[model samples]
Target: MAAKRILIVDDDADIREATQICLEITGEWEVLMAEDGVEGLAIAQLEKPDAILLDMMLPGMDGLTILKKLREQVETQTIPIVILTATAQPNERKNFDQLKVAAVITKPYDPMTISDQIMSVLLTSR
Candidate 1:
């Protein structure tokens, strides 16, 4: 089978690298990355990745806005998005839930377990 392709959008270079390495090693997945929301959106539309790991607190376009935009377009609407954020408070979580995100993963996550968490969420979302 072909490897799953994942797109990770985060402004933090360290976080992006760690996640890319972790997912690539653990999941044997093909990982694509973007520094910010605009690039992320462009990649998502062009690549049509299997899933997106999006950071909630982006500099320009926030994760929620990106999510809304993705949902608005037919080409990328069905792609699952897993939010990576430091703020997963109840109210924030509720918002994510209402937006129909595949999952919300809190920041400072375990690198070793992140791939599993992402996979688990993707599976359950199906």
Candidate 2:
């Protein structure tokens, strides 16, 4: 089987690069990255990745808005989305759940375990 494709959308370059490296090293995953929601959406449409790791806070557009737009589009609606955010409050989790996000990962994450965590969610989601 071929490697899974993952799209990483974040405003922070460090976070995007670190997460990409972790995923690439941990699994047979092809990682694609975008700096902001606008770029992320464009790449998502073009690349049609299997899954997405999106930051809650972004410059051009927020993750929530991006998620909404993604859900609205037929081509991307069923794709798994994991929200990676620094904000892990109760209400934040509730909102993410309300939006039907596949998973929510808090910031200051363990780089070594991030890939495994993502895989776990993807496996269970199916």
lDDT top scorer: 1
Local distance difference test values of all predictions, in order:
0.91, 0.89
In order, how many clashes per candidate? 0, 0
Query: Over the stretch 18-47, how does candidate 1's per-residue lDDT look in tens digits?
Result: 989999999988999999989999999999
Clashing pairs in 1: none
lDDT of 2 by residue, 1-126 (tens): 789999999999999888888889887789999999999988898899989999989986888899988888888888899999888788878877877899988898998898888889999999
**Candidate 1: residue 3 Cα off by (Å):** 1.0
TM-score of 1: 0.95
Stretches of candidate 1 above 4 Å error? none
Ten-residue stretch with the least lDDT total in model 2: 91-100
Per-model TM values vs. the true structure: 0.95, 0.94
